[model samples]
Target: MKPDPSLAQRNLFLLHHFHNDVAKALHEHMREQRRRGEIPPYRVEPTPSGLPTLVKINESQRIVLHTRPSPLAPMQAIAQELSRQPPGATLIFSCGLGYLPCALAPLLNRMKVIVLETDYDILLEALRMNDWGAIMPSGNLLLLAGKNAMEEANILISKHGSLLKNGIRFFPGRILLDEETPTFTSLQTIARESQEIFNYRITSNLQVKKGSYAIVAGHAHKELLSVLCEEAGHVNMDARPVLRRPAVTQFVQTPEMWWESLGRPLPAKLLTFTNKAFLPSEWDKMKAFGIRRFLWCYDDPFRATVDDTFFHHLDRIYCFDPFLTKRLQKQSPIPVHFLPEATAFSEGAVGPPPWDIPSTLPVTFVGSTGLQRQDDRLPRLVSSRDPSYLTIRQFVLDALAKDERIHYDELMALPVEFPNFHKSARVVLLEDLATFVVRLHFLAALVNTPAKIFGDQAWLEPALVGDISRIYAGRNLDYLRQTPWVYQNSKININIFNVQCVNAPTVRIFDVMACGGFLLTEYRPFTEELFRIGVELDVFHSHEELREKVIYYLEQEEQRERIARAGQERVMREHRFRHRLPLIFAAE
Candidate 1:
């Protein structure tokens, strides 16, 4: 088969040589071999500060050699050479290694192909021995096997010493091992065995040294030239030193984290407020631009735990409930914004109503109710549950029994003291929010729809079940039956806590609303601001009003639907995490 015209025209396939003593020695040897007629004659052409290349051929039949040539450059050269070659030109590969396909396959149809494999077993054995304890146990073995298999196949087509006569060279940078370095010797022995087993002879003088040029060899002139194009540069014989230095730190503290005691970036002027994740509406608009920071004032801080890192990193602080704001205002160093706690539309509005509920239903109340000793709650014994109540009552009872003071009925008949105290003076609240939750539950049951109270087992065990459950169910004349408002049947059921906030319209409302039920919620500032009293949500004062509202809303569907729909829109729009995330990340 004829070589490509351009390749044929080029004379002398010079296997690139590096600027090294070994390359000089090899060049002189090749020249002597040519003179002795042991090999084809070719002229040496030195590349400028580059690896030695096979250069100058007269008959276009001289071979050039390279070992482990750079894969990228060779592949490109092979592809280009194939493009110029005539159809049916025979292109023989002396080594059947994996790398050749990347360079040879694209030109396969343009030429005839032949492979020559050398001793295969030695290559496999060599690879295995060297790889037994290497860090990459699996990968090294696979690579070794692949190389051995390919080289073995090469031996079948080519003569035993054909490669040596054609040309054989090592990549200069490849470190050969010596006895002085046991580690190096180990590796060299492995390579030597692999070469012998694969039927490729290794030079007895092959040393554990660093300065060797990457050499590629081929049997044909065209193939030799193709490999020559891959030689990049001569091996560095002088040896270079590596310098190490510490890296400089690049840290930028965002403005939000200013008071963290670490220097922080200047705070941006924009401000944002949210209790939960950023709102989607706010996030979407700001995502395209650089957002500065956000402030999240979490309410129900006791019940609702949050990642403080989030608050610390946020630009400012935000609290929905006034009471929560007051408690945390001084405690937090960040500026706090008090957002009114609003009504959240429960699942009912988004999905189908859980039950057949009218706009106006029965009276309802929902809040926490729990027991504690009065001694647990006093100014002196703040941990006590109003010790004054018990202390005063016990004292009067003792005095009445001794006939030394007014009797129980006489004390009860006395006018109530400071009934308007709550209106006149500020009172520090200390009770757990769960107690309020139970109260709201019964209040809802009494007012709007038959109360569907939702809380954890703790709430049910003490407030709804056991003695109370038997009294309501078995007695047939329960607390509701004795009261003016009565729950028709098993309409009231307690639910577990879905979210944290007590004032916020929780999933209980959604459960009821989805069932087409109404929601009678606590009097939160947000409820009044976000939802109309007669339309979206019904606000309650005391347990009595809660009961009345529940009954009124139950009987009034027109009013209930109006408020439910409005509340649903508000919750889905304003309260959902998706809707709120943007506000969370918003620039402050």
Candidate 2:
């Protein structure tokens, strides 16, 4: 058949955004290959699919490479398969020219297509000859080819892994010759490997890394399991980070898809940050697959709005503070356990950096003041649209100023006038505003001391601090990995718990104590339960007391040393991650 100009013209027109990128990438790849005198074994030819493409020929050059008769049949097969695919779906194709991806664009309701071709030369030829002006944007249809195709394919799978509710629906384009031709065989192998990755993702089987215990973490709790993995126990801790809310919506929109992501049929439970109710409304889907959900929650109960029926979905709940535990127990029928922020103190715990390091530096606070004023939160607060919200927000903020404390049961008394007030918005707003006002008081009071603070620069602004260096210390390396080192070197590690959990100690106390560093923290009712007053650690309730204790500790080095030693001993004995997590998970 003579080359049809209309069809050829459509293929040649590049999606304007991808045109320069394709041309530049092709030119650079070809130039580099010429410099190395290594030409990619690919050439352009017209396929029976009625489009121009690069053919991976046998040495004899007689047969076209493919699993089926032609690429069009596979396109038809994929189209039919995709006709049933739900929205937020993704399709992965190997060895296909750009034509099919574009063809399927209109067929898909809102699906994304990823094309992984074997040769850049073919892609370069397609770009050179065809007018891809009719092609969809790079977002809807992606074309990846050439030497980096495999690497790009791997990344593509991971990036879109969370977006594929239907899992990875693969469309195979062609298969190169057998192993007798090493180059062709290797190229084909990579293509096959890419296909396998998609297959693993689309299926509903579990991929646990350890002996049935996989650590599933998200943004808030990624560091929660850090110490658990380093313990002296026989269990290996595997880190499996779940996607964020938006991306996850694409991959687990359906009940079956949700089950597949959790590695259905496997008895392993998932552990993630409590802040996100990843399956807020999709709990039944997970239960249908016999998958149990486990969560780690630490936020104040008022801020704990994961849908009213969220409790029925989870199998076990682990909370950071006793108060949070009590609130959760009242709302949930499942077992709710308390796990204080902990570190690994067993002999097998992580050792110090491989170098000579100082035992102490100066007085410093290692937390960010991430909260804003009442005005900043006003928009989200019910105060934005309703006048009644003012009374509720002020009441919550006042309670937080006095150190916020309210159980889940007490929340039912939230006026009830607005009907959706508590669940729809107020519960969350109260918790956030409470945190905001309290952080302001804590920082404002502590400014009298020369304790340097390390957090967001906003805390150092003129409104918050008059002397930047004395109050607002500079930032450090990545917070989690570098915090231990920062703690060990600080002379007196000061901690101020956020407003929400003022009645309970924050993780900073344990983190600093685990480093064998002296601690002078704001008073929490639970502090006495964990450490001795002025023995293992010092606590100050009032602003004047906080300043006085800083002066007293600076002068009494021996007492500070004793407290530091005692705190370390306590953590090593009873408060390590190895000790805490087992107890939480063990509670049947």
Candidate 3:
């Protein structure tokens, strides 16, 4: 059936919008990597094809990609072959020689194609050398490259899955189709087994079964264990957690082997992801395997920027911080619901209370100050490399407001180097500035008090160079055992919300209360919404005021204990992990 002209026009409009969105999404992923210091030096390799490709300059010296050369045009036979495919979506593996795209143009009337080109150099080559503006407006094509290509491909598949079910027309480039190159090989293998991949995902998506299973995934093994523990007690379904990768491949490299690892062809009622994109982008490929439900939890959305691409096919998208919830809601159609982090007393794992434990440890603060090193500054990527605090703050705020693709004209004497800094660079830089200055101010206030601080090894100041070592009690606490112990043992447990979330109670609030700790936290608009102020816990509006309240609470031990009990009672009754269920899962 032919489409109406107006509908076709709207599709063109949506496609044009998608081009900008994906470009910005890919850009944000790169900036976020640099912000977190995860970027490694990239090596350039020439391909038989006209342009160059990228490879990781690694110690192992693995050959990254394989491709062959081709001229400005592919033979007529190649064009005919592409046109023969049914009218639907085509998933191309490598951009390869760039000829396939031009060849596929005549078939554009029926085909919506997505090219997942991993070679960054080739993508840049196509953008600079070829007329991309002509190709992009077709409302039927997309090209993704660079560090986040695979993940971005998953997002595309999820968004266009209905069209993709028609079939895959893969073309491998310099990263030749070989077993040695896992990524390229995985695609080739999955293509060979496309029917199985499709079947498993669709089967899993069927209505829930009584004895079937749901999988829970996380960024780390420890996090998987944490969520696994919590869900074990709360869920009606048979919930299972596979620790991050290798354990759960999501049908990328070996679908059959993964199903064997899963022990059975169980239907997936729910697939819970720990907001770090922990569930991988290839999630669409696993849809046939019974992944009917997607639950994504953003424990710290502001600390890292949210990519709505990750929410392409998600069932429920939740963020713990109120600030993030509001911002994400504005950008996404999916309800960006606000759900505070939860905690519960794990009496079994943590044996008995410490013997002869001090009634109280010195005034304690148990979070790592967000700043790590100096390169984290926005000026690091700027042409002038200026680290002026005020300049960086304004730049980041403006950049985030503009969708993390800052215009060159937004700053004074801005460098010509950065075309656009990702929105997350702004987020990360802005967050660092807030944390660095705020921690310093609070630390100065506690210098006279015997305040004991516990934080990451990144906590490099005050003690070594800043000359405030007297109160720097050293190192961070283990979130599982040591933190709970500190909360229960400390006379006045302190909380500092991250600068990104100025108006919400962070998970730390629930953690401290669950452990029955006497609480003194930073003030926020939503703080009172969760707990009655003055009666449950005291909040500080400024460093001086926090110091005064710390003294007052310490002297009034009986009153402090009373407030602590009240806070604990509130958390026990309303803020456990189970309480967050109704917000994310409607039936719950």
Candidate 4:
């Protein structure tokens, strides 16, 4: 009893086009059933109505899928009932031989059609009985089966919840099992909640009138940029003042309140520091409201899980790294540009060295260890499994464990064999590992020296080789206020670049220089291009070079002061937030 070649081809087509986690589960179930020589639970038989019908083969009783006199009557009745409802997405709880979905085929062009079947056996029988090439390939149909069907449905709702605003109709189909009743009820509850949320969103958007400009960022970024925009007298091309707003993380209540406070006037040009600030539907609403959306990728885009859905909503994208910018420009249609990060303006004018005998501390570093442990559940790898089973997280940890100092080129060259793993996740894992290795390698050298490290508790973890307790300062310094003081007070401030940032100097370099602190930074081609090495700022390419520079700079007070002063002058003249504001606000 070989599997039918036509059924195999149809299954391949459906799985390939409408594939998801649920589909994969269903596929594996079908494969296992075929291997075990178990027949599907349902059988097809011709009826007197001239249409084939499905019969559930239960030991207790046989269940007919359609009415006796006319198998098409129930499907026609369901279609007529659907016509009375408002235009919106359609969700069918089960598919019995594909009759219901096939009858609703003409409606697929107008709305999304989602078919959820709890039993994989029934779905297989339906696939084998009918040709779904017309409905499945339309890009509007989503067929979900298996135990986790509810989870997949929730994801689809989150992505396209706005469509439910008009109306949502549910068809229980010709057959509903006792186990599937709960799933249908849960979907109804989710759709109702989503509609309520969208209603609130619409009301809020209606209140705002598009006019001025606003900045959406994290608390620290929002505060820093708001102050800088005021101090710099930032204005748009029309000479209208660019108004600044507070940071918004949730898309619901806070934005509504803020909009009301400002007399409900929406900013014509909205600049957001991160895409995670708002949900995808909120982006669509803002676009509908005539707000031109802009995003600045201060960190690597991969670190944020940025995808095409987010990219398509943005009008312009600015990135810090040249290599990433070029890569994104090639992949996305959005106008991507390279814009280096700049430091906030110093509160007051920087003066000469404060200490007569250079500070007692030889050097100070204020940054994260980048070695924080992740709580993500790593996919377990069974022995003798295929390489494609390896997830990005597992692959990264294994590679780093073997050689913590693996070259970036070698790491990038390694194949990402798993097709299910996303491109962003791959880069993010690599970036995290690279940062951990780079920071640990350089910071390990300072364990012997009198360098004070200000960061989280990751440094004191037993995994690290050296006893860093003496140098590890508690938690963090306030980036806005305390960081500058520490920079200005220290004899030498060390700046280590994360490997993820290919050709861009970290903001630490600019901030240290702006505070008139002698910066001994990691050597990067962009750093050398921006400032004169050893003249404006000194750089080190290796651990030995770092230690040598730190020792040399501490011993020479005159040379340190000369270089620090020159760096501060350059930063104040060219690298402050004021200098970068124009480019950010410039029209395409």
Instruction: Choose the strongest candidate by lDDT.
Output: 4
| Candidate 1: RMSD to truth | 33.4
The alpha-carbon lDDT assigned to residue 89 of candidate 1 equals 24
TM-score for candidate 3, residues paired by index: 0.55
Q: For each candidate, how many residue pairs have backbone atoms clashing (under 3 Å)?
A: 126, 11, 17, 0
Model 3 regions more than 4 Å off:
1-215, 219-228, 231-237, 246-267, 274-281, 286-290, 299-308, 344-359, 373-424, 463-467
State the number of backbone clashes in model 2. Answer: 11
For model 3, the local distance difference test gives 0.56
lDDT of 4 by residue, 28-131 (tens): 56545654678876767778887777778888878887665777778878877776666677888888777788778777766667787777877776677666
Error in Å for residue 454 of model 3: 0.4
lDDT per model, in order?
A: 0.33, 0.55, 0.56, 0.66
Model 2 stretches astray by more than 4 angstroms: 1-108, 113-194, 197-211, 219-227, 232-246, 249-265, 275-290, 301-308, 344-360, 372-429, 445-448, 464-470
Model 3 C-alpha RMSD to native: 12.5
lDDT of 2 by residue, 30-53 (tens): 644654678655555666555555
lDDT of 3 by residue, 359-452 (tens): 5685888876554322222323332334555464466455443433222223323332323344445545555554554555566678788778
Expressed as tens digits, the lDDT of each residue in 1-588 for candidate 1 is 122344311211111111112122233333334445664333322234332333224376543333324423554555565567454322122222223332445554433233222223222212222221211111111111222323322321122222122222222111122332453234334434434533432223212222211111211122222322221121122211111100000011112111111111212222332322232333332333333444444435543334454355444665655555665665666666555432222243232323444332233333233222111122222223244334434444454235332232333333333221232211112222223333433333342234443222223333333232221211111121121122111122222221234344443444343333445654544556555766655665444565565455556667656665665565555544333333332424
Query: Candidate 2: what lDDT?
Result: 0.55
Better of 1 and 4 by TM-score: 4
Which candidate gets the maximum TM-score versus the true structure?
Answer: 2
Candidate 4: lDDT of 449? 84
